[model samples]
Target: MREAYHDQLDSIFDDLAGICRRVETAVSLATHALMNGDAAVAERVISGDVEIDVAREQVEETAFDLLTLQQPVATDLRTIVAALRMVSELERMGDLSVHVAKVARLRVPDVAVPDEIRPTIERMAAVAEDMVGRVCEVIISRDVEAAIALGRDDEEMDGLRRRSFAELLSDDWTHGVEAAVDVALLGRYYERIADHAVSIANRVIFVVTGHHPAALAEQ
Candidate 1:
């Protein structure tokens, strides 16, 4: 019985890792669609967001079932509880990617990003995608050190956002108000995705150590 119960907990962990992979793919696809203003690709990303939502719901159901049926204690209980929180963050990351794709669709034939800040936007997207991939590794391996490293990746994302905003508000800015808005919103979307990755990493640390990484960082 103990072996079977442990296997169930491992299954939940595996499912969470799968959820992370799906969100990572979503962000990459959304970035490609945004760069090219491909309405078709954007539409696909928007519709595909439902898969992430469905996966999150399944993870929640399984975690809750474990809590009720097995009464997991200590690390096992933390694992289930942390899975709930991590999946919520992963779902939000998918939603942010959908928002980016929506901007691509809304702009239609023209790309949402202007030529002036294209590099900055691309940097943000790259940083965000990289962080999500790393977070997936951290979760799957239960690597506390890699989990802590997400903070640095998130900082790089923040820097990219700052550069994007500076360009938007610069005296030479000539992309027009609508383009500026799209750029601003896209930057926020990318930044938020990285933020959520960091949050998941923190949760992974919590599951392993029984203490949130955020508190440890402060000490």
Candidate 2:
């Protein structure tokens, strides 16, 4: 019975890792759609969000089941509890990706991001993708160092967002208000994706140390 309980914990961990991969893929595909003005890719990303949602529900249900039935303690309990919160962050990240894709789809046959700000959007997407990919590794390996280090990536993403806004407000800005609004929204999505990635990393820290990163930082 003890061995079986451990196996269940392992399964939950694996499923959480899988959810991260799904999020990574969604963000990647959504960004691709944005860059290329590909409505089909955007549509696929919008539809694919259902898979992320399902995976999130599975994680929550499995975690709660483990809590109710097995009486997980110590790190096991931390893992189960953190899994619930972690999946929530992951699901929100997935939703942000869908928003980006929808913007692309809305402007179908024409790129949502004007050329003047395309470079910033492209870089923002790249940073977000890299952070998600690294966070997946952190989750799988339980690498505290990697998880904590994700803050640096978040900082970079923040810088990119500021740059995007600066470009939008520059005197040379040629895109009208509608396009500006689209770019602003897109920047927020990318920034939020990075924010969620950092949130997951903080959860990973909790699973490892049993203390939230914010609390630790306070000390």
Candidate 3:
């Protein structure tokens, strides 16, 4: 019976990793749609989000069952609890991807990002993609070092966001206010996606170390 319970715990972690893979695909497709103004691909991303949501719910239900039926303690409890949090983060990342797709869809044939700001947006999307990919590895491997390295990626994302703002505020700006707003929102969406990746990494750290990264930093 104890072995079965441990199996359930492993299943929950596996499901979490699965969700991360889904989010990674969503981010990549969303970026593709944004870069090329591909409304069909953007629509694909928007509709596919439901699957991620459903997977999240399933993981939550399974984790809840483990928590209640098995009454896990120590590392087992931490792992189950962390799975819950990580699933939520993965869902939110999917939502952010949908938001990017929506922006792409809204602009139709016209790209939402202006050429001047396209490089920045592209870099942000690349960083966000890299982070999500790393997150999948972190969830599956529980590599604390890899998880911690995600913080550096998050920092790079923040810098890209600031760069986007700088472009909007530059004296040569001529994209008009509407394009400016779209660029700003896109930057924010990508930045938030990276932030969620870091959050998931920290949760993994907690599961392994039994302490939050912030607390660990204070030591």
- Cα lDDT tens digits, model 3, 152-219, are 88878888999999999899899899999989998989988988888888889999888899833522
Instruction: Give the alpha carbon lDDT tens digit for every residue of 70-161 in model 1.
Output: 99888898888888988998999999999999999998899989898999999899999999999989888999899888887777887888
Assess every candidate by TM-score.
0.96, 0.96, 0.97
lDDT, residue 215, candidate 3: 30
Candidate 1 residue 171 Cα shift, in angstroms, is 1.0
Model 3 per-residue lDDT at 47: 99
TM-score of 3: 0.97
Report lDDT (Cα) of residue 175, candidate 3: 88
lDDT of 2 by residue, 1-219 (tens): 889888888887788889989999999999999989999999999999999999888888888888999887888888888888888988999999999999999998999999989999999999999999999898889899998899878888879898988999999899889899999999999999998888888888988888888733522
lDDT (0 to 1) per candidate:
0.90, 0.89, 0.91
User: Residue 188 lDDT in model 3?
Assistant: 87
lDDT of 1 at 84: 92
RMSD of each: 1.7, 1.9, 1.9
